[model samples]
Target: MKHIIERAQIYQALKAGIKKTGVVLPGDVKRALHQAIEKETGPAGKVLRFIAENLESAERENMPMCQDTGMVVAFVEMGDKVEIKDAFIDDIIHDAIADAYEEGYFRKSVVEDPLNGRKNTGNNLPAVIHHELKKGSDLKISLMLKGFGSENCSRLAMFKPTAGRDEVIESIAKIVVEAGGSPCPPTILGIGIGGTMDYAAKLSKKALIRELDDSHPDPYYAQLEDDILKRVNELGIGGGGLGGDITTLAVKVEKFPTHIAGLPVAVTVNCWADRKTIVELKGKDN
Candidate 1:
């Protein structure tokens, strides 16, 4: 017996998911913003109030929350027992992205070429896709619309194994300071430790999707998150980078095993919007 899924169904789901993500702030992020507004004063508080209002309006109107619709980053977990009928997985994703950007009026920000004759792709095609294989007959997809304001502020550092935890903390603090008002403060920090350079970077991006209300299961990392969040807020970046406490809403860390000689740390910055949505499809054996 085979558990099968249709390509059209997958495409429609992807299309809807991307569109929704662009317009809606995740519950965790929205709640954090409301809390920040209550805790803030002066201009920072005003900014948070405006941001909250914007988010509400965007969802109500079914419109993009931001001018920069951002590049789509997707993480797909596929089950070995189920197959996508009559289409390649990635092609399906690209098609869905293109249609979503067009029909949803999302800004097409991707470039066809990295250098020289750089031209707009016209549609947000060729999403950055990450795939993983998992047990059971289920397809889980998560999408992130990552705007350049935060992406540009992200940093990666490769440290010697002896650099120690203090060094790691210092590095993260340095990033927040340097980023200043640029990444649109009251941002979330996604810190990825260990692993190779690229893997570390990927982990950092993946960390952004973690729920803001949750802490690292490991007590060590959970403590680190608290410490880092405190240090970052001390920067006085505040909401919209106008200056105050609450530069960072949360700090999330994800780590992978790496070689004995290296400790690679990557930080992915996400603006207060933190747009993301996830979809899951289950298949039953016939």
Candidate 2:
């Protein structure tokens, strides 16, 4: 089998994934949209009707589901037996972002420097990459195109170990309520618990990749997911914040055992346009 880590191959995978997934709206989003449509009681429903039509049209056309193509986040899992032909992992991901944005005609939403000399990188290169090595030969790549609208709404809190479940639940609920209409409600909620502030936040963001319809395996946490989902809809932040139930399609929490004195929680919200895809590469013969 030809060892392939050429930038072009990476580009092809990124673009294909973007086209196929076309911004994944979770189950809670569908529920929220329907609730808002039912309760809107005015032309606001018409606005939502239009939004729905637009999403469908954009998908059918293979165009970007949203103009803000978002920040490219690549999750790379390296197989044990594969050999890269001629590229660094970072370079592959960055070039893929650049290629997809340019050739795919998606917006470049990245800034070179956040503080000084702000400049557009033009093609959205230098993706934010998280890498892990695994025990196989074929490489795997997963992606999430994170837009600032939702990303800006991420929150982290460090609580006393005694913070308890209620406190954690409230923090997430408040974030959704305050975020109202922004981040394009109804949204997916990713909760990271038990780590330090930063690790908690990372876990929350990555958890968005979980399929929207699946429940957590742990029953206790699975119940927490359902409880959070139910309460979030009660916030009345319905689809696009037009007012109704269905504020969330899913609530996912990933946790790690932490020090006895701390309870850290982080929430990352993904708008209705929750775009992600994963690809597992196979050799020519396979």
Per-residue lDDT over 24-89 for candidate 1, one digit per residue giving the tens place of the 0 to 100 score: 888899888888888886468888888888998998999999999999998999988877777898
Determine which window of 10 residues in candidate 2 has minimal summed lDDT: 22-31
The number of the candidate with the highest TM-score is 1
RMSD of 1: 1.2
Model 2 C-alpha lDDT per residue in residues 47-80, reported as the tens digit of each score: 5676677777876676777777888777788876
lDDT of 2 at 214: 78
Q: In lDDT terms, how accurate is model 1? A: 0.89
Report every candidate's CA lDDT: 0.89, 0.75
Estimate TM-scores for all models: 0.97, 0.87
The C-alpha stretches of model 1 lying farther than 4 A from their native spots are none
- lDDT winner among the candidates? 1
Task: In candidate 2, list every pair of residues with a backbone clash.
Answer: 28-249, 80-136
